[model samples]
Target: MKRFLTTGCAAATAIAMTASASVAARTLDPTKAEDALEISKRVQCGVADGVPAVYHWSGKVYSRVEGEPDRHLFNGEGMNIRQCVKITDPKRGTGYRQVSREVMFYLDPETNEVLRTWENPWTGETVKVMHIANDPVNSRPNYPYSEDGKPHQISTLRRQGKWLFMPFEVPLFYHNVLAGDYQDYVGNKYHAMEIFDFAMLADEMLDTKNPTAYPTVSWVRISDWMPWMKMRGRQGQMVFNAMGAKLKSYDELPKVIKDEIALNHPEYNKPPPGDDPRPNETTWTVFKKMVDKEREAAKNNK
Candidate 1:
C-alpha cells in the first residue's frame, strides 16, 4: 500500500552533487525491468563460501513535533551485517528458504564507537526463513497509485547481501535530521532534506545534543518512478508508523516506552532495527534544547 523508490531521475541531483555519487550511481531503475534484472545477474550475490557477506551501518534516530522539542531515541553508531541465502533442498524436500543475520554494535554517542552489542535473541533460525525478498513496489500487480493518481513506485530490493525495504530511509534521517539520498537494487529513490539549508549529515553518523551537530535538520522526500506531480513527500513523523504500522506520538508515548514495534509489526517497521535505538533520555534532552534554541532564533528572525 505504501510507496517505494525505483531507479530514475529522482535521485540524480542529490547523488551527482555528493561525494558518494560513485556508489550511488549503481541504483536500479524499475521502469526498465529487463535492464534491472540484467544488472542483478551481473552482481555477485553469493559469498566466497556461497554465503552472503553481511552489511553493517552506523546511524541515529530523532523525534520532532510541532509544540514539543525534538528528541533522540537512538544515538548509537552501530553496524548491521546481514547474510542472504537461498536454500533449495529442505529436510521436508519441499519449499525454498532465504536467510539473513544481523549483528549489532550499539555505541555511545559522545565517543562515536560501540558501547554494547545486542543480538536478536528472539530470532531463531526462523528469522532467516522469513527472509524472502520483499515484493517490489514497481512490480506490484495490485493498485499502485495514491488517491491523487500520482504515479508511485513501491518495491523492495536485495542484491548480494545488501537490502533496502520500503519507507526506511525516512526515519533514519529524521532521527539525525540529515540530507542525502541513495539508489537501491531496483533503482528506487531515497532522500533526506537539509532543513534550513544547514550542514549535511552522513548515513553513517547521527548528530546528538551537540548544537554544532551536522548543523542541519532534514526529512525525506520520496518520488515514485512516476511523474513529479504524482510523487508524494512524507513527513518523517508519519513514515515511522507506516513502517511499523503502529507508533505513539511523543506526547502520546509514555515517559518509558520500549519500542517493541519492530518485533510486533515488522511490516510497519520493515527496516529491521528501525532508526537508532539510543537511550530515550538523550533524545529528550537534546530535542528539548534544540527546540528551545530554534524557537528563540525564530523570534529574532521575525
Candidate 2:
C-alpha cells in the first residue's frame, strides 16, 4: 500500500532467486547508478517513456505473537498500476518521477471472498472490515545523484544464471495518524517492514532498447493489526506473505479482483496522472478519513 512498496499470495508464489557471482558479467553494469535506474525502471514501471505497467499479487495474512502459534487470519489480494516521467535538473542531471495507486482487499480465509465483517477469535464481538485502498503512492523525483552530489547508487543486486534479483526492503516507522500527537515522546509511531524481491531476466532488465521487464515478485510484510480489526491494542503483528508477476493487461487479473474493482473503483482502472500532485496515502490515514466521514454523516442525521 505504500509504494510498489507493497503485494501477496501463498499459492501464487514461487521460490525466490538468490544472488551468485558465477553468473557472467551483464550488458548493463549494476555498479553504475544510471544503469541501476534502468534496471529498476524495467522492473518497477517501464523504461520506454510514459506508459502504464501493472503487477498483481495475493497471499495469506496471519497473526504473530510472542508466545503462541501464528494463526491464519485472512487472505489478501492487491495490485498497482504505475508510470514514470522524465525529470531533469541542471544540478541533479536527469531522473524519473514515479507515480501510482494501489488497492488491497482482506478476504475470508475459508471462502476466499472479500470480508465485509469479521469475528475476532480473540474477542467475541464482530466488527466491520476495512480494506486498503491507498491512493497516489508516489515517490519523489529520483535522480542519479543525491543532494550531497553523490551518485544515487544501490547495493544487493545479485544475478543467478539468467535471473536477476532486485530486493527492496522498506522500513516504515512514521507517525500513526489515528493515534494521539505526543507520539514523538509517547512511542506509538507506526512501524512495519515490507520486503519486495523482484526476480527477472538479467538481459531483459538491462536492455536499453526495451520499454519494460516483467518480473516475478515476492512480498512479505510484518506490521500491526489493521484499525478496523478492532484488536483494541492487542499486542501482536500481522504477517502478509505473497507472490506474483507483471501482467500485460488488466484483464489478466483474477475474476474476483476484476469484478470488485469494476464495481467499487473506477479510477483504479488506470494509474494516477504522471504529474499527480497529491501526497502519498497509507492504511492508517485512509482509516482516519473513513471514521471522520462516518462521524460527520452521523452528526448530520442527528
Candidate 3:
C-alpha cells in the first residue's frame, strides 16, 4: 500500500524544531484546529533544523516481495517501516539528530503465540515484552472489541503462494493510530477506550552526528481506534505528541480491500497452538519473570 503523504528535503527540519520547542510546555489538544500544512510538515519530522527530509507519521513496510522498489512500504522518499517518527534536531546538515521507532506485533511465528515486544534502538533499550498463545480449536475468526465500544482487529497468517503475510488492523477502527486489538485488563473481556498492547514511556535518544543534540520521545498506542470517526470527526482534531504531533485522522481505505481479507488469514498468519508444547510451563514462567525484571530495571533507571 502506498502512503498518502509525499515528503521532500527542504526547510522542514527547522520548522519542526521550532514547533517542538513551542509546544514543549503545552499539552496537545485535539479540539483546537491547528495549521494543516504546518502540522503535516512538523509531524513528519521532529524539531530539527538544517536537515533534509524527515518522516512524519507512520512508516510503510512492504509485505515481503523480492526485488521490489521500496515504494509501497515507505513514503515518497523510500524510507524504512517506521510506525510513528519525528526528527528532533539537526545534525551533519543531512539527517535529524534524534528519532523514534514504535513496533507492534502479536504472537511469535514459530510458536503461534501472542508476543508483545517494545524497544528503542536509539538508546539500545527494550521496554516491555508479553507473550500469549493462540488457541487452535477455540480460536475465533474475529477479535473481540473493548467494553468502551472501541474496535479490535487481529492479524493472522495468510498464505500468499508459498509465503505467509499476516494482515493486521484495529477491530472496528482501521485508522493509523490504532495499534492492536483492544482487550480488557483481565485478558478475558474487551473495552472501548482500552489502551493498546504497546506503549513506551520516556525513551531517550542521542544525536547521530558529530555535533550532538538533546531529544527524547514518548509513545502510547491507543488499542481502541475507531475508523468511523473520519467521516464524522473533524480533521486534525486528534493530536498526538510523542515523537511529534500527528493528525489523528487518516485517509479512508476502500471497502474492497477490507472485504478481501477477513479475520485470521491462513497463509501468512501462524496457525493456532498444537497439543505438543516443548517450552514447558516452567520455562515460560521463568522467561516471563526475566522479562518483568528487565522492564522494572528500565523503568527505575536501575
TM-score of each: 0.26, 0.88, 0.16
lDDT of 1 by residue, 1-302 (tens): 12325444446656666646444444345344333332222121222222332222234544444466654423422111222222222222211122222222233335543333322222221111111122111111112233454333424432222222222242222222211243333333333332111122222112112111111222232221111111133222311111111111122222211132243223422222212223332222333455678889999999
Q: Which model, 2 or 3, shows the larger TM-score?
A: 2
Among all windows of 10 consecutive residues in model 3, the one with the lowest summed lDDT is 73-82
lDDT of 2 by residue, 140-243 (tens): 88888787788866586898999888898999998899999899987878999999998989777775545678999999999999898888888999999999
Report the candidate with higher lDDT, 2 versus 3: 2
Question: How much is the lDDT of residue 42 in candidate 2?
Answer: 73
In terms of TM-score, which candidate is stronger, 1 or 3?
1
What candidate 2 gets wrong by more than 4 Å, as runs, is 1-26
Evaluate residue 34 in candidate 1 and report its C-alpha lDDT on the 0 to 100 scale: 34
Q: Whose TM-score is greatest here?
A: 2
lDDT of 3 at 282: 21
Ranking by lDDT: 2, 1, 3
* Best model per lDDT: 2
